[model samples]
Target: MSSVEEFRTAFRDWLRADLTGEFARLRGRGGPGREHEAFDERRAWERHMAAAGWTCVGWPKEYGGRGATLEQQVAFHEEYALADAPARVGHIGEQLLGPTLIAFGTPGQRERFLPRIVAVEELWCQGYSEPEAGSDLGGVRTRAELDGEEWTVTGQKTWTSLAHRSDWCFVVARTEPGSTRHQGLSYLLVPLDQPGVEVRPITQLTGTCEFNEVFFDSARTPAANIVGTPGEGWKVAVATLGFERGVSTLGQQVGFRRELEAVIDLARRNGAAEDPLIRDRIARAWIGLEIIRGNALRMLDGVSAGAPGPEASVGKIFWATWHRELGELAMDVHGAEGMLAAGEPYDLDDFQRLFLFSRADTIYAGSNEIQRNIIAERVLGLPKEARP
Candidate 1:
């Protein structure tokens, strides 16, 4: 209920005062590529945040949220990044699944799930991308079949972030026999601790296993676990995707800004800034970032009306491509020294990890190719690309 400025002032004051002691040591300890570092410590910090009612500030008050305004939410993210706080471990739950449930989940579902997320008592991972279905979500072949009182699920999901640490996975599975593409899919909240589930870490180019391959062979969730009607999960799944790109994107920009500033500092320290091309690229990165902010703000301003439309694809393409390019610039700033690992068995510095991991920026969530297709068909009314 507070005005944006009031909320911002209070949040900034609280953050400055509270991020000290053991928490002070945790600053900048966890993030995208560095998730494997200090996880237990970061988890404790998140619990401290939950104890302070600092988690999920934007959900509905009825659902144990602060019901914060859009401006207040944006301010929270900006300040959190300004403090260089660790990337949250509950992101998939708090940002993606919580909102999706609020919009699509039944009362029983909401009551069962929302409080756990707000408290960070249960961690969740996205079960969307598969080895064969990463970019083309409609290609998901994870099949769940309804039995007497449970749905038995069998499928493999790859690039599943933090699945190794997650207690549950929100899985999209083919639930109807003979159905194809986007039809007959169901979003099931499956517990990961069950015997039928297996999680194998996939070490990336950064030499960290923040992602996993989740194999579900006869995994079971109660039949009541489906979020929408059994066969209408594409709609539910797409809504979750929209949340994945929602207000959190603004916070992500704050991290991007921090990374950019660090890259600029690196260039100056290493004398890379003296090169004319390096200077030009840095300037272009700044300008592109400005354009990204403008597009993202405009997109968010319309939230009162509805969820983001297809034009959201524009923001996705812009930022992902921009970040991937910035990663290249990060390596370029390091020059020849960038080629060597910081040590043995995959010891990489921050810049090395940034350069390697950002390669996936354009590929995950939705690939650049898929985003272009969505824009052309849904946003521009262009002819759909010919499908085989």
Candidate 2:
């Protein structure tokens, strides 16, 4: 086997041996505790993965990582999902913000932040979406004013996932008062425990506060907290979006595949597998999963080859559509039981949660509409739509 393959094999063996004991203690019998405790468990898991040199597998060794190949990183994610390990809590930090910082941040910034992120010592949240800036990020109205050594930020950011539990937030604020959209924006790392910061969790249909609305009133962050040059934040934001829609999708696709398999098994036990139409749908779902896997491998290959491109947008679109279809198929197979939530004492309550969460796949990480527009304008050289 190749070096990458050997690493993957060893990693798999280690995970199989260690994950059960760690997860059992982390989750306890009734599942993780309150939100903070749950996040702590996830952080502990990340520390475990990092100690094994598996947390930031693709990062360079100088940055406290294994410097593993892209293939090895993909293998780690696949095995992690297969092992049913708890999802990493610092996803925004590890996948999106961390990569952006490594690429665009100064050496001092990297030294101070990267190790903490890999060790899960710092939890981070993305402050992108606002009441009016959900799909149109350029419409962000959050303002930041320079005050000698610090920047005072004031605004409301909606849909701030994990903000309540995060130690820091990477926020985009309008630094130039009269600048046009997308211009004069700056990305700042704001501490959440500061006096002027407020976070309110938004309860979803699942009765879980998985996301939040964050308000900043005269929130002050050191001017040195800016990730890149002040006026150049739009590029950094785009880079962060690319990582969010690409690498993050790879992890989700693997987890979704497991859910798809469980749905298939449930269908078989429920007699829905005998229906020709249902079989065909399940077959199509399998094909979709294969497509995602193949595209993700190609992406990893591109990253390894040091020529990353816009093809990750294609993977993002495909993965979202596939997840939505899988959820629909699960609901169809489960019939009435699929609609039941976890506390309903039903056979397929877990699948119901998956079904509900899948509804947001097309919306987050840039909406499917945005993805289609990107593919058409950037990839296919299509004519742009006229603004009203």
Candidate 3:
């Protein structure tokens, strides 16, 4: 076998050995019972992956990574999905903050933050979506004022995922009051354990507090915590969102494909296997997932070649729509059983939670509407929308 093929074979074997034990333990807990201990389990798994030098496989060797090739990184993600590993606990750190730091952070910043990120020692959350600036990030009203050597940030951010459990947050705040929407913003790394920061959990429709509202009243961060120059936060924020919408979507596509396979298996076991409509839907989902996988690969290739583009918006839009369709199809196949809660005596209740969570995929990381607009403007060279 070729070197890449050999590496893939070895990696797959190792992942199979490691992930089997973890998944067996998880499956024994019944259907998706990681609600309470999810973070702990994810942290442990991340540590295990880090020890195997696979946590940040695509990162440079200088930054404590294995420096795996793009193909190897893709293989790692594929194997991770096949093994059904628990979703990451610190996605904000792993996906958004980590990449941003790698690009814009100083050597000291990288040394201080990247290692902890790999080890999951410091959980991170995003402070981007304020109550007034959910979709229109340019309208962010969070204020960060320079006070001598420190920047005191005062504002409220809503729908911050895992803010209650996070140790740090990467925030965007207005540093120049008189400047227009996008120009005055600056990104700040705010530590959440301070006295001025308050995190209140926001319960979802499923009665789970997976997200929080973070209120920053005179939150003090050092001048060193600023990312890039003052008033360049909009650029940093866009870069972060680019990673959020692209690289993060690659990881999620793996899990979504696994879920799609599970739905197929569930349908087969049910009487729906003989239904033509169900089979057609399953086939369509498979094809759509393949398209997403292709798009992800293309994006990775572009990144490797140093020619990254806005094609990630296309992938994001496609995967979000495909995931919603998959959820709907799974629920339809489950009939009434899909509606039951996990603790109930039903077999397919896990799909209920999955379905509800899929609703947020389109809205978060820039709404699908915003992504469509981006594609229309940037990809299609369409006329720009008039600003108010």
Measured against the true structure, the TM-scores of the candidates, in listed sequence, are: 0.98, 0.92, 0.90
lDDT of 2 by residue, 1-388 (tens): 3587788789889877777765656532111112434566667777887777677776788987777666667677777666666767867788787778778998888998999988888889999999988967888999999999999999999988889889999999999889767899999989999999999998765556778999999999988999888877898888888676544456566677778889899988999999999999999999988998888777765565443456777887888888888878888999986555546433325666667767887987788887788778888899976653
Write down the worst ten-residue block by lDDT for model 3. 27-36
All predictions: root-mean-square deviation over Cα?
1.1, 2.9, 2.9
Give me the candidate number with maximum lDDT: 1
TM-score of predicted structure 2: 0.92
Model 1 misplaced regions, further than 4 Å: none
- Ordering by TM-score: 1, 2, 3
- C-alpha lDDT (0 to 100) for residue 388 of candidate 3: 85
- For all candidates in order, the CA lDDT equals 0.91, 0.78, 0.78
Please identify model 3 stretches exceeding 4 Å from their true place. 17-36, 246-251, 305-308, 342-348
Error of 3 at 283 (Å): 2.2
lDDT of 1 at 263: 97
Compared with the true structure, what per-residue lDDT tens digits does model 3 show for residues 161-275? 8888899999999999887779989999999999899999987755567778999999999888999989988878888877665444565677777688889889889888689
Per-residue lDDT tens digits for candidate 1, residues 53-144, read 89999888899889998888889988888888877899999999999999999999999999999989999999999988988988889999
